[model samples]
Target: MPQMSPLSWLILFMVFTLSYLGFLTMNYFSTFYSSKTPSQININSTSHSWKW
Candidate 1:
């Protein structure tokens, strides 16, 4: 079995945390934009229907 140095452990932890945060951020923005687009489409449809 091999033991890792403190610095190596620290780097690994940092990389994992950063990747996790990035994934969460991407997921959040995707959901946020998806919701926004649907609402905008609904609004546009309503406005167009009203004009007729």
Candidate 2:
């Protein structure tokens, strides 16, 4: 078997870290929004959060 260098190990660690962070962030945001009431409960556009 071939021995892996330190540089290769570092690169692998960084890739794994970034992907894990992204997965966690998505889960957190989804859970947060799912528990909130709809922001469009007010039919009036002037009172809506998406006012143009």
Candidate 3:
């Protein structure tokens, strides 16, 4: 097998790290919001944090 250089290892690590960050960012920040009534909205705002 061919040996990999330090630069190649660093580049691979960076690529994986950035991809993981991007994945988490999109997963957490992106949400599905359907049309909700005013009462439902008020209840959600007043209640404690529970995304699920």
What is the alpha-carbon lDDT for the whole of candidate 2?
0.79
Candidate with maximal lDDT: 3
Ranking by TM-score: 1, 3, 2
> On lDDT, who's better, 2 or 3?
3
Q: What are the Cα lDDT values of the candidates?
A: 0.76, 0.79, 0.84
- Quote the RMSD, in angstroms, for model 2: 7.8
The TM-score values for the models, in the order shown, are 0.53, 0.51, 0.52
lDDT per residue for candidate 1 within 1-52, as digits (tens), equals: 2376877889999999999999999998787433456545644334434554
lDDT of 3 by residue, 1-52 (tens): 2366877889999999999999999998798768888766664447677798
Candidate 2 colliding pairs: none
RMSD of each: 9.0, 7.8, 9.6
TM-score of 3: 0.52
Q: Is candidate 1 or candidate 3 better by TM-score?
A: 1
Give the per-residue Cα lDDT of candidate 3 at 11.
Answer: 99
